[model samples]
Target: MIIIGERINGMFRDIAKAIREENGAVIQDWARKQEERGARYLDINVGPGSTEPVRVMKWLVEETQKASDLPLCLDSTNYDAIEAGLKVCKQPAMINSVPAEAAKMERVFPMAAEYGAEVICLAMSEEGIPKDADSRVALAMELVATADAYNLSPDTLYIDPLVLPCNVAQDHGPEVMETLRQIKLISDPPPKTVVGLSNVSQGTKNRELINRVFAVMAMGNGLDAAIADACDEELMAAVATARILLNIDIYCDSYVDVFMKG
Candidate 1:
């Protein structure tokens, strides 16, 4: 599974203050830490707090690259900010998402193709999050059809089934799994499946346990990547164990240690 480090976003109070203060030390430190924790990509989001998001995005992208050579996932609803980060990124970055909405696709998809970047296509349209597997699949199909215009292949797209808070929707776990199962059958080469795994534990008391179990279950149902807290050793260990059990990794007694060392 591809682990996207989710710690540097401005949504967090510490990161927000660091961004506001132009704290390159904090940004670079966090970037190095995430990379050491085995993140394949670092997700950088200026979020909504930035008064000058374009400048902040540029700084964070540059600072992160200075600390680690890992590719970035530019996360924002603002296309300008995304482009700003993209401009500074050394490699083809991943756009953390474009929804199935037509206007959003028009903005993100073309830029992704133009930059030779990968895209995360949310399985939600303008009408909002679908309640069932069938509806989610419908929206994902729309994005798949649109990908053809930009010459994007299955590998260039990461399809998020839009996992909701399990606390709010009791049946969401099953619904998401069903959506994952069916998403693969729609094409000869399916879009890579990913989840913002933390969303499953939002507002819950036992967040780590819930996230670990959900990661295992989601991987079984076809999830190949996640944006998550890689700093949590226990949670990442659980994921390593699950992957080995699923035969996605070679089994060894010290597999968890080996996985983290990568």
Candidate 2:
């Protein structure tokens, strides 16, 4: 599974403080720890809290690059911030998303293509989050078409079928899984499917339990990646075990080695 480390986001209080203080030391420490723990991409979100996200994002991107060679997932709803982060990125990274809205597609896809960055397209739109599998598939199709028009190959587009909180809607996880399966069925050489794995347990008491169960189910239904807490040992163990069970990795040698170093 493609693990995008989610700890560096500005939504977290400590990280927000670190960013506000321009603490390169704290940011570098987080990046190094995530990389050492086996994260493939480190997700950097300026979030809604920052007034001057572009400036902060540029600094974060540069600092992260200085600390590690692992690619970043430049995350922001602000197009300018996304562009700034992309500019400072040393490697081809992932844009942490565009929704199904036409305006979003127009703004983000061109940048993605120009920078040779992979993209994550959320299965949401101007009409708001879809509640059913069919509507979700329709939104995904629209995103796929938009990417194609920009000459961005399917492999470079990661489709996130927005996993909802199971505590609020018990059927949410199954619906998302069905949507993922449908996307794979429709696309010729389907785009990679991913999720914000923590979304499944939001507002719930047994968060780790919900996250692991939903992750295994999502992987079984063709999920290839996730944005999750790289520091969570239980979640990481679940991810490693799921990969072996799904036959994505042979034997568990790589997984074991990763944990041993941790």
Candidate 3:
């Protein structure tokens, strides 16, 4: 499974302060640490912390690259900040999202094509988050067609089924897994499915346990990647275990160690 590190996002207090102060050391430190913790992409976001998002995004992209060459997941609703971040990114990266809405697809698809970047398409639109599996699948299918029209391969499109806080939307958990399964069956070489895994346990007591359990569950149901807290050892270990069990990784007694060290 692909791990997009969530620690660098400015939603966290430390990250928000770093972004506000343009603290390169703190930002690069998080970037390097996440890379060492087995992240495939470092998700960078200014969130509500940045008053000058475009400038801050450029700084973030450049600063994070100073420590590691890992691709970034440029996360923002601000189109100009996304563009600014992409301009400074040394590698092809992932766009944190576009939704299934027509205007966003028309815009974000072309941007993805131009930058040779992948994108996460939220399985939502003007109707908002669907409460059922079928609606998510329908939105994902539309995203696939939009991707094709832009000449962005299905592989470059990551469809996020959009997990809500499971504590509030208790019954929706299984529905999301079903959505993941349906997303893969949409086409041959299906659009990859990802989730913001931490959202599953937000505001809950057992955040790590819930995140790990839900992550492994989603992996079993054809999840391809996740934007997650890589700093959580149990969470990462669980992912490694799931990968090995699913035969995505070779088995060994030291499998977890090997996966982490690699």
Candidate 4:
């Protein structure tokens, strides 16, 4: 499974303070730590903490790269902010998202193609989040078709089924899993399926337990990647174990140690 570290976002208090204070050390440290904790990519988000999002995004990207070589997932609702970070990225990065909206796709897809970057397509559009697996899959198909139109390969496109908080949307858990399973059948290669893993347990008492269990369950339904809190050791360990059980990893007594060290 691909891990995109979600800890560098300014939504967190420490991260918001770091961004506001222009603390490169804090940002870079989180980047390095997430990479050491087994994240293949770091997600950088300025969130609502910044008044100058574009400039701050550029700074965040540069600071993150100073400590870790992992590619970034430029995450912002602000298009210019995402573009600013992309401009300074030394490696091919990913755009954290584009909803399945026509105008947004027209902008984001070409930019991704030009920068040799990947894209995450949220499985919703102007109408709103769908209530069922079939609707999510239908939106995913439209997203994949749009990416293809822009000459982006299926492998470069990630379809996010948009899992909501299970506390309120209990039935959504199984629906999202079904969406993941069906998404893989959309094409021969299939656009990868991902979810914001933390969303499953938002506001729940057993956050870590819920996250770990849900992550493993999602993998069973063909989840290929996740935006997650890599700092959660138990969650990462669970992912390693799940990978082995699924025959995606060679198991050994030290498998968890080996996976975490990566």
- lDDT for each residue of candidate 4 in 150-184, tens digit (9 for 90 to 100): 89998898899998888899988888989999999
Residue range 1-262, candidate 2, lDDT tens digits: 7689998888988788888888888889899988887788999997676889999999889888888888999999898998999988889999989999988899999999999999999999988888888899999999998999999988788999898788787776667889989888767778888899999889999998888888888888889889988777787888888878988777756785665243
Candidate 3 lDDT score at position 33 = 89
Q: Tell me how far the alpha carbon of residue 257 in candidate 1 is from the true structure, in angstroms, after superposition.
A: 1.3
Clashing pairs in 4: none
Local distance difference test values of all predictions, in order: 0.88, 0.87, 0.90, 0.92
Q: C-alpha displacement of 5 in model 2, angstroms?
A: 0.1
How big is the positional error of residue 81 in model 3, measured in Å on the Cα after superposition? 0.7
Higher-TM-score candidate among 2 and 4? 4
How far out, in Å, is residue 165 in model 4? Answer: 0.9
Best first by lDDT, ranked: 4, 3, 1, 2
Q: lDDT, candidate 2, residue 155?
A: 79
Model 3, C-alpha of 234: deviation from truth (Å): 0.6
